[model samples]
Structure formats: structure tokens, C-alpha cells
Target: MTEKRSPWRAIVLVSTISSYIVGGTVGGVFLGLWLGNQFGAKPFFLITFLLFGLATGFYGVYRAIEPFIGDEKKR
Candidate 1:
């Protein structure tokens, strides 16, 4: 028998997911900015890295939620 998760667990999970996305995007932005400044191509690197970061963030969210998803399927 599976135990039900607490509401606090859900809240914490949501917070974690948001943090992952935000941290990744912010980190990417900073890295892109630095690279752009070094290479004299601000807009290009900024957009490229921004998208990459967003994608990475989503991937992290997927990974974090995968276990819960599996549990639901089992139920």
C-alpha cells in the first residue's frame, strides 16, 4: 500500500521545481552575458543561452517529477 503525500510535500516540490527553472535560466543569462561581452556578440549569445537554459530547466522539472508520475501510474 502506498502512503498519501502531504500537502506540504506538494508545495515543497513546486518550490523546488520553480527554483530549478529560475536558477538555470538566471545562470544561463549570466553566462551568456559574460560570453557575449568576451566575444562581442551580446544579443546572439544571450538568446541562445537563454533558450538552452529554459530547456535545461524544463528537463530538470521532468526529472524531479518523474518519480511521482511513476507512482501515479502504479496506482
Candidate 2:
């Protein structure tokens, strides 16, 4: 039998993924600032945030696709 997903699942999934994206941004900029201050790095915040966003975005996309890609399709 095929499994079914509750409509709420999409809402929850979107919310969760949005948070991850936000976290990546925060981590990149804040972490960069702190580390840069301590190590005198240039554009630390910007660079960190950029890289973090890329990685986090990819991860988020992968996770978002899980339901659709899983062995059992949820209707």
C-alpha cells in the first residue's frame, strides 16, 4: 500500500527548510565576523556567509526532495 502524507507535512517541511536557510546565513555572517575579528581576516563575514549559503541550500534541497524520491510515494 502507498503511504499518504498529511497536508500539514508540506507546511512543516517548508517551515523547517526555511529555518535551515536562515541558520546558514546567520552562521556564515556571525561566525565570520567573530573569527575575522580574532584572526583579522578580510571579508570573512561575506565569504563565510556565501559558502555557508551554498552548502546549506544544497542540503535543504536534498532534504526537501526526500519525500518524493523515497521508495514509497506519498499521495
Candidate 3:
């Protein structure tokens, strides 16, 4: 029999995923800004960061629901 997961585990996982994605987005934006200066390109660092955050958020939501879908298939 599979062990049951606590509600806190689900909460923590979701929070962790969201945080990591947001942080990665910020880092990417900063990198873009720096590289843009080096290459003399007009880099829209803010736009990149926002898009990353948006994409990651969608992924996070998908991940959050994935466990439910998997659990159902096992039944």
C-alpha cells in the first residue's frame, strides 16, 4: 500500500516550486541586462523576466494538478 502524503507536503512543494521559478526568472533578467550591455543590444530584461515568471507560473499550476491525475489513474 502507498503511504498517504500530508497536506503540508503539498503546500510546501507548491511554494517551493513557485519560489524557485520566480527566482530563476529574476536571475535570467539580470543576466540579460548584463549581456545586453556587453553586446550593445537593447535588451528588454524586464520583459524577459515577466515572461519567464508567467511561463513558470503556468508550469507550477500544471505540476500542482499532475499528482491528482496520476493518483486517479492508479485507482
Best by TM-score: 1
Model 3 Cα lDDT, one tens digit per residue, 1-75: 244467777787778777767766776677667766776773575566557766776687677666766665676
**Total clashing pairs for each candidate:** 0, 0, 0
Which 10-residue window in model 1 sums to the lowest lDDT? 1-10
RMSD each, Å: 2.1, 3.6, 3.8
What TM-score does each of the candidates earn? 0.86, 0.68, 0.55
For 1-75, candidate 2 gives per-residue lDDT tens digits of 222457776677787777877877777777777878888884966697669876987698678767667536432
Which regions of candidate 1 are displaced past 4 Å? 1-3
> All candidates' lDDT scores?
0.90, 0.73, 0.68
Candidate 1 lDDT at 38 equals 100
Ranking by lDDT: 1, 2, 3
Candidates 1 and 2, the one with greater lDDT? 1
Query: After superposition, which runs of candidate 2 have C-alpha atoms over 4 Å from their true positions?
Result: 1-5, 70-75
Worst 10 residues of 2 by lDDT: 1-10
Question: How displaced is residue 46 in candidate 3, in Å?
Answer: 6.7
Q: Can you give the lDDT of residue 6 in candidate 2? A: 71
The lDDT, on a scale of 0 to 1, for candidate 3 is 0.68
